[model samples]
Target: MFCNQCEQTAKGIGCEKVGVCGKNEGVASLQDLLTHALQGLAIVAVAARKVGIVDPAVDHFTAEATFACLTNVDFDPARFETWIRKTVELRDSLRARAEGAGATISNDTPALSYRPAADLAGLEAQGVALNFIPSLDENEDLRSLKQITLYGLRGLAAYTDHAAILGQESDEVYAFLQQALADLTRNDLGLDELVALVLKCGEVNLKAMELLDAGNTGTYGHPVPTPVPLGHKAGKAILVSGHDLRDLQLLLEQTKDKGIFVYTHGEMLPCHAYPELKKHPHFYGHYGTAWQNQQKEFAEFPGAILFTTNCIQKPRESYQDNVFTTGLVGWPGLTHIGEDKDFTPVIERALALPGFPNDEDKGEVLTGFARNTVLGVADKVIEGVKSGAIKHFFLVGGCDGAKPGRNYYTEFVEQVPQDCIVLTLACGKFRFFDKKLGDIGGIPRLLDVGQCNDAYSAIQIAVALAGAFDCGVNDLPLSLILSWYEQKAVIILLTLLHLGIKDIRLGPTLPAFITPNVLNVLVDNFAIKPISATPQEDLQAILA
Candidate 1:
């Protein structure tokens, strides 16, 4: 099994023997098969749509299936095998029904087929390969475009799946995913068509993200500025990691008054900003930094750790027993919290563990100052700008990973002028969030705009500012210096490009899959540049 779909892939190459994310050979193969089957199902769905047959279930199935194959989503081979068999059965049943109906469907139409009632074991044992892998097109440029489009769809599917689980649905985004997946499997498409599809993926992904943002902000009040504690308090504690705020909410609710202190980890660090979530007294603080530091950080921890989503590294034996997975994230031996989202087992484990008798004093870290909170202080911010006290705005954010080049974020944030404001989002800000950058005027130098998805807020603020200044977004005095580590970043980058935003800086290494020609198109069209020289030089370049 060879997989290199994430930043921590072995030695910056494909992971052959075992996944760097703790996905063993069996799990990796199962995820590959799951992805392949989803593509096949997508083919069937697209065909059916041509005949005016649309199955909402099929759209959801494809979305969830694709999401399950994301980097750190699933790692239980047994559960994944079940998912693959179900997907194959679903696809075959749908195909048979379509043929039976003589659907006369167009190649790209969406369709749904029902499955015959049978045990999935037989289907699993057949070892049928879902023939959805796109052949390497002779035109390298076209192949690169297809890769970009496919990866973008993967990112969209992941976000859509999360929103769907929260009872939110966007028919348009679902249709786009089905259409794009089918197109990727088609060898007949040319470069121009693939390029168009790539941009379309961007446009639809923006919708998917907007849907998620609405789901989050509508459910929990808009996030506000709140400082989070970094030190561990004495007594029983549990660390809630990953990006799912709904799960975090449930955990915070259940653990209340249970003598178990709750802490955020990794991407969940920004959850503290939401007014509804922050009001919880037990919602203590963040633990450690990004996902890469987990193996070392979790080793001596005295309580259970709950992972709700991606970026789970291979665990060390010392803490493996204490780690629990919920939602899509899974591992071979880790205890899993299923659909009910019941976290009792994790809470019980936390109680049983010998938690720290004395508080570990790591001090407090600032976070939770998302868009709403910032807007609340708009008057002060505008006044500072008017007074010429705040000279510039820097959007320095994106994903964080184990790669060496990631330190560029640390240096870049450190080099920002004291008079400028640094707006950040996602785990990328973990590098500088702990650094006391102080404040310019009344605003903190480093403002975390929530999680990576909160990049939407940053975008909104930029566009609004541009409107206020009576200029285009690119003409604003704002600069976007991004660091990408996953497909979500890919979608966000495409969204920025689609908006005609130019002269952005991206770094900590470019994607391995991007061809030189495709890179040239990006550079030429958007003036996207890789990070170079010291932070001082890069900051000067952006300021200039």
Candidate 2:
């Protein structure tokens, strides 16, 4: 099984024998099978949609199936097998419905008539056909564009699923996702059509993010300036990680009055900004740093670690038993909470383990500087810029990884002049979050906007800044320093590109799957840059 659909693929190349994310050969192969089946299902769903037979369930399932194949999301082969079967079942049902509705679908497409192997060996026998590496299209450029579009859809699906949990639904986004997936399996579309579709993925991603933002802000209220305690409190505790706010809310509700203190970890750190979740007394401070540091951090923490969504690593033996997964996240040997949302297993584990003996002084980190919060203080920010209190703006944010060069972000943020405001989101901020950058004119120098999805907020903030200054977004004294990990970051970058945002710096390294020609297109159109080895020089280049 070969996979390179993430920032931290093996040696900056595809992962072959085993996933760098700890998905063994079996799980990785299963994910390939799942993705292949989903593409077939897309063929059926897209055909069915052509006949005005819109199946929301089929659309939603495709998104979910794609998400499960994302890096670090799921590593359970059995679960992936289940999803493959489910996707095939849906594909068959949709095909029948389309035929009954007199939809004209060519039976010639291999994707339309895909049959899953009943067993692992059978799955392996049908190997190369199931892999994404072997594209149906012969043109290398078109293949690269198709992959970019497909990965974008996978990222959009994760966002869509999260919003759906909050009762927010967008039919347009779902339809486009289904139609695009089917298009990937089509042999007829040329490079021009594929490139246009890839750009459209960015547009649809913006909509999906908007839906998620509304769901989050509407449910939790716009995140106000809130101080999140970094240290733990004395008591039975549990550390919640990943990006699922709904699961965090349910856990908060279940842990209420139970004496088990709950803490946000990793991407869930922003949950504190939401007033609804923070209002709970048992909901205490944030624990540890980013997802990459989980093994060490989880062991150090005496409480159980609960993963709500992706970015889970292979657990260490010390804390392996203490970890629990829920809501589309899975890892072998770890206890999983089903749809019941009953976090009893996790809560019991927390109770059995010794929590922090006493609250330690780990300092405070600020989050919740989402779009609304920034917009609320728009005038003051505008004044700060006008008065010269704010010199430049650096948006340093993205996924965090164990890769060595990632320290460039930490160094860059550290070197930004005190007068410059640093805007960060997602887990990449973990490197310097504990460092107090101080505030400039009452605005924190280091501002964590929100999770990766909250890049929506940074984009909003950038657009607003441009509007106030009466110039294009690129004309502002702002720099976007992004560190991508998975497909979500891919889609977000595409969105930035779609908005015509230029001179963006991407690192620790560019995606392995992006060929030289594709990179040329990106560099030519968007002027995208690879991060320089020297952070100081990079900073000088940006400030120049």
**TM accuracy, model 1:** 0.92
lDDT of 2 by residue, 1-544 (tens): 7788888888887888887888876777777677777778877777787788988888778878888888899888778778877888998888888999998777676666778788766665565455656554577777788888878888989999988989888989888888788788777897678778888999899999999999998988988778998877889999899999888888889888888888998889888988898899888898888988888888898988889899999999988999999988999888999999999999999999988888787778788888888888889899998999998999999989988899899898888988899999889889888788899878888887989999888888899889999999999999988898899999998888888899999999998878789889889889999999978988899877
Off by over 4 Å in 1: 10-13, 96-102, 105-136
**Superposition TM-score, candidate 2 onto the true structure:** 0.97
Give the per-residue lDDT of model 1 (tens digit) for 1-544.
5666666667765677887667776666566556656767878776676666678878888887777777767767677767776786777777767766665534342222323124434333322232222343657688778777766777888889878766778888988898787676567887667767888888888788888888888888888767788887888989888889899999989998998889888889888888888888888878888877889999978899999988787789888989999887887788999989889999999999987787777888777676677777877877787788988898989888877888888988888888889999988988888888899766788888888888878888777677666789888778888988777888788788878889888887776667798889888878988888568788777777
Strongest candidate by TM-score: 2
Clashing pairs in 2: none
lDDT at residue 492 of model 2 (Cα atoms) = 90
Candidate 1, which ten residues in sequence have the lowest lDDT sum? 109-118
What TM-score do all the candidates reach, one by one? 0.92, 0.97
